[model samples]
Target: MRELLITWGDGGGELAGRLVRELRAAVREGRLVAGERLPASRVLAAQLGVSRGVVVEAYEQLAAEGYLVGRQGSGTRVAAGVADGGARPPARVVETEPRYDLKPGTPDLGMFPRAAWAGAVRRALQGAENRDLGYRDPAGLPQLRRELAAYLGRVRAVVAEPERVMAINGVGQGLALLVQVLARRGRPRIAVEDPGSPGTLALLRAHGVRPIGVPVDEEGLRVGELAASGAQAVLVTPAHQYPTGVVLSARRRTELAAWARAGGLVVEDDYDAEFRYDREPLGAVQGLAPERTVYLGSLSKTLAPGLRLGWAVLPGRLAEDFRQAKQYADLGTGAIDQLAFAALLESGGYDRHLRTVRPRYRARRDALAEALRTHLPQARLQGVAAGLHLYADLPADTDEQAVADAAARRGVRVATVGPGRLAPGGPALALGCAGLPEQRLREAAALLGEAVREAGGTVREAGGAVRDVGGLGGAVS
Candidate 1:
């Protein structure tokens, strides 16, 4: 243990964190055998001349991260499988694997704030009380609820109060819970924005709630259509419609809110509103109709999705029922995770992270737009100023499947919007730019352009005057 700590670093304030990292690396590298007993916190601390709290904290963090297991009298041991020592094989890059991944549903993983997140976790563990460690309220940790409510109010103009907020695993779970509650409340059809997230539509159906798809145009979801569909409850991505990228217009917002004010339920998925680049993002529709809106948001967009953290702001009438539903769902999400997220939010660490990441995402978005302009000039790109994915409208007669298949053969994956949603509008592709940098985005554009032509569509040329559209001649380092 002393040797391991020595190899990690000279002990100080970061001793616990460094120890956790060091032990994790040892387990991953096969230096630590699985099921091997670890030194007790006191013994290890004495041996290393550090406080026992350091070792205890290290053990706790490792346990939380699933790297180590601790038992009362059994002591701690390295976890199985992920780090079995000597049995783990080396990693190698697969040549046939796609060179770049620009598919939607993932964020720029490279920009994750490792140090800040670790610090937040450390602080949360140190500050958490004994009661906080137990199976507590299903509404989520009060600390997290308080912080998240404040953060949402200040950042999104959301009408959130701690008592009415419920922390969820992510938007998926949030929607599931909402659907269940609504289904029990006699809402059989859950209206959703057409050209919206198909995954969400599937989620609604899987939860036994029929989905009513309403058409969305340039200004956003058609409120007229929504009202005509006869759905008392609707799930919408109003900030930026999935696959369409249009913000809800002022008229539409007023109309939707008025509908909700008249007792219609609104479930707002404010996806990617934090990453907007054009103008200030519109306030959430939930804010427009708090009494009827159930606002759903998650860190999946602004933060790493792997964190699996999100929250729902429920109306006063449904808040208690939603909390009870969450309690029955999974006995509530992990409290430690909630506390850590709260710590990050209270310290403004989350905001700082967004500030740093937003610009990078914008640059990637710009690169994709530039590539599209130069290579696939016949395709007009819309919704480029917000969200990680942009909607590329191909010629009215272009074959979407051919463009999609051709791009797939070349190593890029363009989103293929299926039937029911693409009606009336020409064939379009939701090109995701978040996962790739400038050069890869440009290359992806060039590949898609070739696919479009092969699929019986014409490509426009800029007379060869611009060598690289969007200054993407070479990949930005």
Candidate 2:
């Protein structure tokens, strides 16, 4: 009862009144609990540097208001019901601890190379100079940009020079910065893949830029549709598309390059390019059209998302504008994290880690396919060649959301493929298999089967070698 938090407001009002208001607010805000004994008046008065009479007056007022009760020799206690304040309105959505989480694009966090990362960070600190500790080039730490340029060029065959590369917090920050740059340059409408990363579309719209949807097929973005979309700029995931897991085909790549050459700008999101299971992943589209494409890649998928590290390799002309935007974004990303990432890249530690983790994800992908085949034979799976998840098409009549909700109840979580600004096809499911143990993957698939049947829909396999279903509707402008 000796410790009480009381802030003495401006001496505009009586000290006792200010104390009473603050105490009531503390209880209402749950900072003070019911039935908890408060400090003696003299004790609180001394702590708050106020007079004992003021404390007594505050306590007396609060007691009259039923906010305090003085028990025999028990000192002053908060009233049992005073702390509740009032009943709160129901929340719009109540999040529960999920039994089985299958959210898309989520990596196996447990597999993060903590030892290597810590070692890299330690080395970075040991090597950092005093000047490196100060505010640096808004583009990024010079060492990191140089390392990134070389790493990207050797691995993805990108035409990146250190001078044109900018380190960002993550791909999201890079996108925001690029959007600002483009909007200033009179390009506000960007065509995105239909059913793309809805977060990307939302980011654009939130910043007053319009995102037009261009449908993507088995090969990837329909360049013809993009050209006709009347958008001056476009964003794409060429190595591996999101939700649907298709690579941009070579012919369409040529068309996209040509379109970019004809005064259009392309922003490439090279996320999850490290996890391709089939073969050496395709080179970045920026390599084919370096003059017009800006390539964005991040460590969120490979390393822990908490690192918040990524980079953008821009066309030389666009690099300066991006640097200015980056400067204004946060002054710059942290120097410690940047130098640490540079150490990781220069020491060949990053390559060694990729070698260790790639096979693990590949095995998980295989397990997902097997589980789906055994349990939900009626469902068609696509996008299994790479990335962390698969796109599943259930029987035509199934209610996607109902099935997902039912699966959630069965201790398995699944997500319905969002329609985004365009409906790619029938209601689709995006199921992530990474991080889940083999047994859980099988169990999740079984749960999906049960959920579908429970939704009053029959499970019949699609009648075809593969289900490259046609568009459910036209492109969304």
Candidate 3:
């Protein structure tokens, strides 16, 4: 048998401990098979230039750990029933990369301000106190909280104070924490916008909260339906509704505020409210009823989602409980990242970054709208005034999934509105316009038009003449 190989670095544990670890690894990795006899203590000790006592100690330890078996006449052998760590599980099937990706819930990752972020990180680290690096308040860094409170108040008209801000991983984590708090408070049911974010619905269900779906229309979430659902709490994306991109009208905002004033809880998800093209985005619903609303915001849309940095502006009543939940959920977010973001906000770098990317995104959105109008004049587009994506309502008879699949085959990917819908609705597609360039977006829209036509949708000419297309079969050019 080959001599046992052991790495004994300086200050690595005792020689016997090292030998025991090596042998146990060998057995677990299947390098040493079951019933394989190890070299005698004396022989191994001589080969490894260690004392025989050290080898004996290691062997005894391995035997105690059930990694080895010793017999009176036979030498120590690898034990049976040991799992092989080297064995691999079946490989996961990977999907092909689409030529044009138009899925929602993602921004242009290429627009991340790497240089400015790196600078902020460096400055934060250099200026940080020793205590700042240690265990921090579960609520978040004080400086970051202050910056977030000020920034939100200024940008989104959110009524916030530093004390009420809780640093969180993202809106997803914030929602989870809110669900936990609500369940404890005996309010276990929450109303969400119908055809809202399916991810949010699944997340609430995962946390044991029953989500009641309320209908949404051109005016936004139907407050009348929400009231009828008998849910005391409701989650809304008011500044810009998801998938549909409709801004809540002034009348609905007043009604929602009235609902909150009458003792309903409002959980406002202020996602992607900073990218309105025609005018400035509206103030948050939380600003109207600060004491009754829990406002959540994240950098996932503005910055890269990979940062996982976000904040929650809570009502005074739920602040402590949410902070405790955050504490227990990974001892709060990373301090370095919090400090870096705070510095960026303080230095006005974040606003500048937004200013730079806003027009670029708007250009992409325009290109997509124009492309859809040019290629598929029959499709009606909505939610184009704000947000990173647009909702294209197809003909009622069009098969949404079939169109999505046909588009995929043509190397153009889109998100179907089916999964996001809780109630039966018209067929539509949510196409993201933030990830690709203007020209690529035009190409994707042209391909999507072809897919729709192939999936039995009517194609209308610019002069409004309808032409019927055949079923899906021929390949897209």
Candidate 4:
């Protein structure tokens, strides 16, 4: 055993107990793994400025609990099987003091209603029938589908009845199911937004479906281009378009409905629709043309991402095909989670939670915008009207990866839209604002602004060029 110097608040009456608590926590967390030797009592006592007896007493207690073993003259060591010896790989870059993290699609986890959710889970377990504990309907629990239908109807105006709503694992799984069904039906070319979610693009491509990229602009997905793509189906964010925050214009929505009516299918991903700030919540496009659109939603955003609960409201024509697809895809979602979610909805807890989080999210949005305005003043902020992130168009001349790397170096994490592009290349950053605290947002922005400056670019209004104060000439054109 080597001397492990443990630090505590004060080396007084409670010092030994505190030290034992920390040591146990380290063991539990896998920091002090099985077979790892502990510090000698004398050495630890000297290091912590405590009496040796205190350290001895703590070690004895730990030994008694099987956390440690004292071999005669061999010294004390962590007990085998007390914890696994293998440790998770170290972080690529440790965040000793990360000022900001602007990676997109993450919610403010701090705002999650832990108390209410726990209570709901308990109640659900209590009320669930014996049959609910067994292998469930691959389509999902009846109660969840019923509750989800009513909830979606009220919130997004989705025309869903209990029979039409099929719960899946998450949006990813729902998309996979849709892809399988559509591909089996011979619809291979699924059009998507150009700078859409890379993961979603990859998922579509995995099932032999060709993802044709149609460009998105301030008004959202370009309808004319989508028509020109000759694709049988299109995946759209609609309410708040990914990476750009553009709501599908009413004309475009009508046009899309007409196109779908003519033949094409619209796979509506109402992602982040519940978080819209500047406008009244928009109704799902599926409501306008129920027979032509498939509405997908998840608790990933509204609740916690770990829940892995999502639903698909299929058009009447495609309902059976989707269910068959679901049957072949892992049986179904967990019954307990579905029941818990249903309880949350039935008790009006979900809406109550949403009401609380919206303001906090809005404040976060405001903080990020203010930070950008103050620090990266020359940068253009797009997608600010809604969603958890904004697309900041950097000076046209600046390479986005260089900016991303520079930000990483300074403890501010941000990403770019270029790499996500099917046909890559764009001068923009995807700045996520939800996970960061407001006080640190300013500091993070300052670091990011400094990084941009270092990368031979200037900050300015979105459309304005970044004047190269670094003397390399104007970077933005």
Candidate lDDT (C-alpha), each: 0.79, 0.82, 0.85, 0.80
lDDT of 4 by residue, 1-477 (tens): 544435587656676688788788777667788888887889888887889998998998888888999999889888888665555546699635445677777687877889988888999999999999887778889999999999999889999988889998888889988888887777668899877776676676777777899998877888899999998899998898877777888999998999899999999999788998887878999998899999998877777677888999999988998998898888788988888899999999999998888887888788888888898887988764677777788887786766877887888778667645676445787777778777777788889899888875533335332221111100000
| Cα shift from native, residue 455, model 3 (Å) | 1.3
How do the residues 1-477 of candidate 1 rate in per-residue lDDT, one tens digit apiece? Answer: 323434745656488888887778878877777777788889888977889999999999989988899987899988887574455556786755466555566788887889999999999999999999899998899999999899899989999999988999988898888777866777666787777665675566687776787888888989998898888988788888887788889999999999999878998888788978987888899888999999988888777778889999999999888888899999999888898999999999999999898889899999989889999998887763888888888887776766777777888776655432523446777777888888889998898888888886533232312111111100001
User: What lDDT is reached at residue 334 by model 2?
Assistant: 91
Error of 4 at 90 (Å): 12
Considering every candidate listed, which one attains the maximal TM-score?
A: 3
Q: Which candidate leads the pack in lDDT?
A: 3
Task: Estimate, for each residue in 164-190, the C-alpha lDDT of model 3 and write its tens digit.
Answer: 999998899999888888878896568
Candidate 1: lDDT over CA atoms?
0.79
How many backbone clashes can be found in candidate 2? 0
Q: Give me the displacement of residue 69 in model 2, in angstroms.
A: 25
Provide the TM-score for each candidate, comma-separated. 0.76, 0.79, 0.86, 0.76
Residue runs of model 1 more than 4 Å from their true location after superposition: 1-97, 419-425, 457-477
Higher-TM-score candidate of 2 and 3 = 3
> Residue 74 lDDT in model 2?
97
Ranking by lDDT: 3, 2, 4, 1
| CA lDDT, candidate 4, residue 250 | 90
